[model samples]
Target chain A: MIWVAAALLFWGMAWALNAWLARSRHSGLRAVRIAVPVIFGLTILVVWELLVRGLNVPLVILPPPTMIAATFGGNLAILWEDFVQTFLKGALSGYLIGCGAAVALAILIDRSPFLQKGLLPVGNFIAALPIIGTAPILVMWFGFDWQSKAAVVVVMVFFPMLVNTVQGLAASSAMQRDLMATYSASYWQTLLKLRLPAAMPFIFNGLKIASTLALIGAIVAEFFGSPVRGMGFRISTSVGQLALDMVWAEITVAALAGTLFYGTVALVERGVTFWHPSQRK
Target chain B: MNRILPILSVVTAIIAFWYAAVVPMNIHGVLDQAERDGVVVVPGTAKARRDFASLGLVMLNPGQAAKSWMQERPRLPAPHQVAIELWQTTVEKKVTSKRSLVFHAWVTLSATLLGFAIGTGLGVLLAVGIVHNKAMDMSVMPWAIASQTIPILAIAPMVIVVLNSIGIQGLVPKAIISAYLSFFPVVVGMVAGLRSPDAMQLDLLKTYHASRAATFWKLRLPASMPYLFTSLKVGIAASLVGAIVGELPTGAVRGLGARLLTGSYYGQTVQIWSALMMAAICAAVLVGLIGLAQRLILQRMGMTGR
Candidate 1:
């Protein structure tokens, strides 16, 4: 009861502080802007920890955040192995191959208006469909290994990357192309000097989207079938054992890997497309 | 009309490719069956045949390759076989029958629709709160964006299990997942939409002495329609996927996802293919309906450029 009361009091104080900080004249400062959310997140975690302990929620149903953290800390080696199997081997390799193929194909099809018109709508339609259904079939074909997970990730990322790269290739204005023509720049030269640079933003958008899909595809494919190691394998198995703490641990790894992967892509985008309006600031 | 021919040709090319790939993918199994039936195959031993690539095996047993398309559990079911299975399960079986694809689709669809409604409602309310309150905008907005980068779907199984232990079962568990998956996109899109009114527009409202609620109803809400519909399309698709994935962890026996799981377990390639086709059709139809609604609403609002 005391713990619950303390948690409630802390929540009120934290929210009030946030509300005050948000209206403060210094709120525009970068430090204050970052601090507000950080404080809010910490508040939630603290409240969650207190409430679970105070209410005596069962560990199987919901582990406290501190216990989850302890589990995560205790299982570092196992978590690392699963992370390497799922993210580094399965997702990353598939992301490279799939996105590479899509960009190459996009450039090839850029020369033909007929192919573009035909493929764009088809790509869009397929992208919206539940392409994840292919996970089972691919798992069967590739065997219960990282290779199968990679294959699923490949199929998942391919169409979106293709569509984005194709759209990006068309992003440059006729005026820019005409200027290149007036300078007598060859097709390859013009592509390198102008269109590709203009396409970087769109390409990065595709990359960011594909990065998330790759992690998801690799993890979910393992749900269909996988070897003894991998995040999905651990998650499903742990759930069966009612070891909710371990499941939370695996989820923490997935969340970290996903955020880092996406953040890296966005960072690269900012560096590459600094001149683009969205990145100019 | 100008676009029709290219699209048709593209579709034809894909189907043709799928048929051609089926031969190689299933050739080894086909040859094994043929050899068992007393028909001689080149490099006749199964071990010798296993050493060769699938394409080579197909070449060595062209006559046997035709059998691949008709195999009970081909590595890849031929397109027509999938289409036939889809037709049979959907049309031939009664809707109430356990074998019926319609029954499975309905189970999944109901959960999806329920989740989408809950997610969209909560998302809109949150978006409104964020727009109206500086504290929420500052504190919650970044987390909402960051939450999307996390693979929240990975927790579907845990969510299902946790809810089950609490005596919350059936449609609600699946709908909870669907709602969680769909929630972020709506919040993000709605926030952008509600804030879309430019300085000039807001000034106009202010000059008219509009109350905050009146300003929101007339300006912000209407301005958010196009953005709302766009995210709704994305949200609904995500919701459907969530429901399917939620079905997976529970080993639920009644959804399309269960059909896929059981088929995979039993090596019923035909059944898996049909369930996949059904899922694809459901996704297309749901998205199309949302699109239709978007068109109608936007047109009624006089927001469409045309």
Candidate 2:
């Protein structure tokens, strides 16, 4: 009861503080902007910890964040293995291959307006479909290993990457192309100098999207079948064993890995597309 | 009409490619079966044949290669085989039958629709709160954006199992997963939508002495329609995927995910292919319906471009 009251008081205080900070002139400062959300998140975690302890919620149902942290700390090696199998060996390899192929195909088809028109809609349609359904088929074909997970990631990322690259290649305006023509620039020169650089923003946008999809595809494909070492395998098995702490630990690894992966891609995008309007500010 | 020819040609080319690739994909198995039937197989030994490329096997036994498409469980089922299976399960079986793809699809669709509605409602409400309250905008918006980077689907099995242990079974658990999956996109989109009314438009409302409610109803909601529809399309597709994946940990009991699982377990590649086709069709139709709704609502409000 004391814990609950203390939690409630803390939550109320944090809410008031955030509200005050948001309305204050200093809220425009980067520090205040960052602090508000951090405070908010901490408040939730505090409240969750207190409430679960005060109410005596079963560990099997919802393990406390502290317990999850402990489990995460204790099982670093296992988590790292899962991470490499799913994220590095499966998702990363597939992301590179899929995006590379899409960019290559986009460039190859850029010369033909007819092919572009034909393929764009098809790619868009495929992108919106539940392509994850192919996971089981791919798993069967590639066997229950990291290879199958990689294959799933490849198919999942391919269409989105293709569509984005194709759009990116067309980002250069007609006037820019005409200027290249006036300079007697060969198609290859113009493509290399003007078009590919212009396409960086769009390509990066696709990469960022595919980064998320790659993680998701690799993990979900493991649900269909895996070699007993991937994140999905651990998650499903832990749940059945009612090892909610282990499940949460794996989830923590996944969340951290996903955020880092996406952040890396965005950071690279910032460097590569520094002159793009969206990146400039 | 001009675009139609290109699209048709592209589709035809894909189907042709799929058909051509099936023989090579399934040839090793096809040749193994032919050799079991005492047919002469090139390279003479199964051991030698195993090391040879699948395309070489296809070339060595052209007569047996056609049997790849007719195999009971080919590695890659032919497109027409999938189409036929889809037709048989959807059209031939009774809708109430467990074997019916229509029944399975309905099981999945209900959860998707229910979750979509809940998610869209919650997302809109949260967006409104974020937009109106400076505290929420500062505190919640960043986390909401960051949450999208996390693969939330990783928790689907855990969610289902936990909910089941708590005595909440069937569609609600699945719907909850779907809701969680679809929630972020709608929130982000709707936030952008509600704030889309330019400063000039807000100033006009202020000058007219419009109340906050009046301004919201008359201006903000209308401006948000385009963004709302775009997110809804994305949200619905996500919801459907969530529902299907949610079915997986339920142990091959029902839904499209079950079909995929059971097919894989039994090595029924044809069944898996048909389920995939059904899922694709469902996604297309759901997205198309949202698009149609967008057109109708936007047109009725005179929001369409002249």
Candidate 3:
């Protein structure tokens, strides 16, 4: 009963605060913009904690944030190993290979009108292949190591990166190409100097998208088969053991890793494509 | 003719590559077996000789060398083997049979459609609330976007178990997972669409003294049609993925996900490939249907440029 009251009061106060912030002239300020969502997130967590404790809900069904945080702290070693296996070994390696191959292939395809017509549909078809279907087969081929997980990531990330790079290669206008021709520039030289520069924004878009996909592919691949380590393996095994706290802990690791990976890619993109109109601000 | 020619050439090239790849990928296992039988052979030497010379140089029985490429449970199934399995399962078997790809596809499709419906409804409602109300716009929108950062694969098992504990089972839980995935795109798209009516349009409605609901239906709703259809395409594909993931943890005995799981368990590479092809086809069909509907709706609304 007390928790119910507290939850209601907190909700009401948060609503009032947000309403006030929304109406205020200062709402557009950077601090206020950040504070609004932060406060809202905190309120929801507090309410969730209160409701779970007050109702005596089973921890397996829903662990409070505190329990999740505690489990995360206590299991740092396990978490780190899982991170190394899934993120560094699986996601990062596959991301590099897949993105590298896609970029190279995209450039090759750009040179040939026949390839552009043929490969784009095939690429799209491959992209739509469900990761669930691919992950298990990959595990079989590559065994229970990080190699299989990386294979799945490569398959998952390849087509999206390919499609994006293909589109990006065409970003430069025909006039720019004609100008390059007038300068008597070689095909390779024109690609390096003019077209590649124009393609950076789209290439980075693909990179950022692939960053998330790589994490997802690596983690999900572990669900099929892994050598007793990795976020996905830990997550699935913990669920079977009914260790929901540990499961949530793995979720926390995966979420943080995903966000950091995406953020890093975006930061790099900004650095590389600063001159683009979209990144100008 | 031009489109078909390029596709055909690409497909032929891929088939050639697959056939060539099977020997290297599958021969390792056969060599390991032969070594166990006390055949004193070096690893790379044998593979290199096989690559350059005829199969006779590598093995007494050349047929065994050929057999490596066509093993029933080869590490990498040849393209034709998978194609044959796909044809047999999809065409020879009755749709109601457990072996039929159509049966598994229908199971997955049912959950996907259910979830897509729920997601589309919830997304539209939330988008409407966020667009109309200040608090929801400020609070809910950020959280909605944040929800996507947490991978669905990680959460799927937890969702299944938690729901199972509460006596909810099977299709409902899977549908919820699908809805969780599909809803976000819809929310983002619908929010953009609902707010698409410019100030001038709002002013015109205000000049007519129209009620908020009337103005919404008359001015805003029509403007959002293109965005809604665009998001629906993305949402439906995502919903299918969600359904497949939902099947992963439970190890259910039906659905395309189950086929993959069973195939992996038994080392049936051809079965896995067949399921993968079926899922891809299902996705293509779903997306095509959505595109067709989008065309009809947009044409009727006379907004075809989108």
Ranked by TM-score, the better of candidates 2 and 3 is: 2
The candidate maximizing DockQ is 2
Give the range of the ten consecutive residues with the poorest summed lDDT in model 2 chain A. Answer: A272-281
TM for every model, in the order presented, reads 0.99, 0.99, 0.92
- Which segments of candidate 3 are over 4 A away from where they belong? B28-69, B203-210
CAPRI-wise, candidate 3 is medium
How do the residues A195-241 of candidate 2 rate in per-residue lDDT, one tens digit apiece?
99999999999999999999999999999889879899999999999
Across B150-229, the per-residue lDDT of candidate 2 in tens digits comes to 99999999999999999998899999999998999999999999999999999999999999999999999999999999
Worst lDDT window (10 residues) for model 3 chain A? A124-133
Q: Per-residue alpha-carbon lDDT of model 3 for A222-269, expressed as tens digits?
A: 878899999999999999888999999999898899888887888898
Regions of candidate 2 where Cα sits further than 4 Å from its true position:
none
Q: Positional deviation of B77 in candidate 3, in angstroms?
A: 1.9
How high is the lDDT of residue B213 in model 3? 98
Using DockQ as the yardstick, the better of models 1 and 2 is 2
Give lDDT: candidate 3, residue A126: 70
In the range B232-255, model 3's lDDT, one tens digit per residue, is 988898899888888888888899
